[model samples]
Target: MRPQQGMIPWGPNTTAGGRAGTQGGEGAVELVMVNPTEQAAIPRGGNSLQSQPDGKGHFGGVHGGRFVAETLMPLILELEAAYAKAKADPAFQAELAYYLKDYVGRPSPLWFARRMTEKLGGAKIYLKREELNHTGSHKLNNVMGQILLARRMGRTRIVAETGAGQHGVATATVCALFGLKCVIYMGATDVERQKPNVFRMRLLGAEVVPVTSGAGTLKDAMNDAMRDWVANVADTYMLIGTVAGPHPYPAMVRDFQSVIGEETKAQMQAAEGRLPDVVVAAIGGGSNAMGIFYPFLDDSSVRLIGVEAAGHGLDSGKTAASIERGRPGVLHGNRTYLLQNADGQIEEAHSISAGLDYPGVGPEHSWLHDIGRAEYVGITDGEALEAFTFCTEMEGIIPALESAHAIAHTVKIAPTLPKDALIAVSLSGRGDKDIFTVAEHLGVTL
Candidate 1:
């Protein structure tokens, strides 16, 4: 039976293959993924960069391409063409830019965490307060971009998957703005934990689908949404919440989200007259991290660090440290590192933070890790809780549970880095959505 309206629950004993099985066992399904090397050939005459598959060969290099099942190829091709045209049109870009800056509140503050920095006794910490955005998370950035693209493509409906429901809220909000029909699929567990956001999505006029498959997390919701897209591809555009997934999405999300770093660079330069010594962000599907890191990819002198939730501990079976425990494999339309068993069956990634719990990182992140351009690290649930509380106390800021992973690193590394060095961390979202969960963790009530 389909889950009831509002929120649902998922557990370790649950499975996501209910619908996916009828279509095909998600079993070892492989799709050709593009690598960066192949991207060079795409711009041959510069007829536009859409022709090349992202780095591996699926669509656009590094990011951009198709990853749907064969049944959805016609719709995928139509979307590909629409996106391609919209990308090249100046009017579309300008219109979207206006909404980004005005409607969704782009160029969010680059705040200096003076109190927190002083207490840590190390590097100065600056925060990209994406939490200030309209929907209270960096997810708004991508949703706005995708929904606009959908409008330009003449698409009338949108679909998405959410874990903590922040992305679902964002997508629903944009759909309301554009007067498009919206549907969101969410894990039952996530729905129960993030009730407020679920209500918010409903208030915005979206149909919320409670996903009952898998452990009822982000992946399960994604599977359900993908099935919907396959069935309704002609009129629906799947607004993926993160920078993971197949080709075009990873690249497309990064492009829309790059505004974070773009604003950060200008703000830091004006405030400090120089670039930061380091950039830090928590990684799930890697959209936030990639948004901040992609622009800095060419900056060899700056250090880039990505934090993943360590849940209980990496030493235990319960952890979401994909970089530490995962191996290279393919899942969800891309070839990248994934947390999987010996037979390549994806494993459940553990994290106390619902938003950070995922079994895979973005393909570009996999490449970044392979080339050593970025350092990936993990922080335990205990450490994250400490940092979460510390930030609220010292800085008077309530950070998202996921962002606490990066904050936890500051707790450990701040004392070690030079006091004069500058560090910028992506505070990806606000804490209102997490208040209930954190309250329960702290033995309190709202």
Candidate 2:
């Protein structure tokens, strides 16, 4: 692979391997028979009718209610109330916009990938350049909003879990911005693979705690963070990075992230004079996809496609293709689709992309998939790597491996469309952090 700025071939691998994919949510379609029939479980073009989650955190009879120990319930209740108030407060909204503009750099570009579009020979492709955001990637969008709420709740410390380290870095960035004590729990394996990000967090004055339990992956990191939150509920705010935790969290995070789609809608119409034919994003825990897909849900004409990580292949027993092959199960405090074995135990998820390596997806995503509001497909590691290379060479952009999954899928379908069609891919993050991973994948030492 060719080199780009901030990339050099002089050291051992310092970043996790390239991502397989990342993980997504719900609405207007319905909230009742999750999988009424076996045929409806995987619909063709989301054509099948189905039921889904209720307002009380139960999707299609799948409960997303809290299952935490009693000690944390009071704080959870308090958090729920605080969030409600904050959501309705004008002051909170104003502050959030101000930071998004002046600090996190809002209004990320929606650029037409002319070269890539021309190469594809059919659809006009747009890159929602979220990688250009201040802290790099869409993670900062949620981090800033959550930190603002944390400050409003009088919390003195911030705690979060991270997989590929982007969210951890973004959380650390906001904590430093707010002058709050920050503690980040990262899997020990992630810490090693993401050494640069670990140093970056420490450089920003956040403690990077290496979690050793389990496989020391993203799931294990989350477990450790939850334990920490319970131990210090009064003083610490558990800043969940994705839309998977519990009630209010999935909805809350989606609201904060909706900015991506909100911007995309206005920007696309302004640029193309019409809505795009399709909008696609990578899913790990489903934040970026939800952000981009939520605003377009009511627009029945616009297609929403979410790409998942098929680490090896769907039949390999090592992929993270939850919606495509997983069963409905509870994980990480929410009931959602998860990869599990016959014994009902959650299986380890594999993805070259650290961010997409989770056993389950957000509950709302489960609802969406069931109701046919959106469609999901899997992209393998090699395919994502190829897309990563193509984007850099063709569009002069190096995307995060997580984001590459979306691009990998986009390229496949875009070329088959008419020239009048438009396809937009959320360039979720920069790939500077994934150089080592790519090097490893290519049998090269950085």
Top candidate when judged by TM-score against the true structure? 2
lDDT by residue (75-101, candidate 2, tens digit) is 877887797677656677778878888
Models, CA RMSD each: 12.0, 12.2
- Relative to the unseen true structure, what is the C-alpha lDDT of residue 221 in candidate 1, on a scale of 0 to 100? 92
TM-score of each: 0.86, 0.87
Q: Report backbone clashes per prediction.
A: 26, 22
Give the worst 10-residue stretch by lDDT in candidate 2. 15-24
lDDT of 1 by residue, 1-446 (tens): 11121221111111111100011112212211111122222233222121223333232122223455788766655655676566556666677778887898876888999999998899999999998999899998888879988887778989999888889999999988878999999999888888888999999999999999999998899899989988887788888888777656776787678777767766777688777889999988889998888656656667999998888887688888877778767777776667888888999989888888888887667666654668999999888888889988987889998998888886777789999999999999888777888888889977
Model 1 sits at a Cα RMSD from the real structure of 12.0
Candidate 1, run of 10 with poorest lDDT: 15-24
User: Which parts of model 1 are misplaced by more than 4 Å?
Assistant: 1-67
Error of 1 at 44 (Å): 14
lDDT of residue 285 for candidate 2: 87
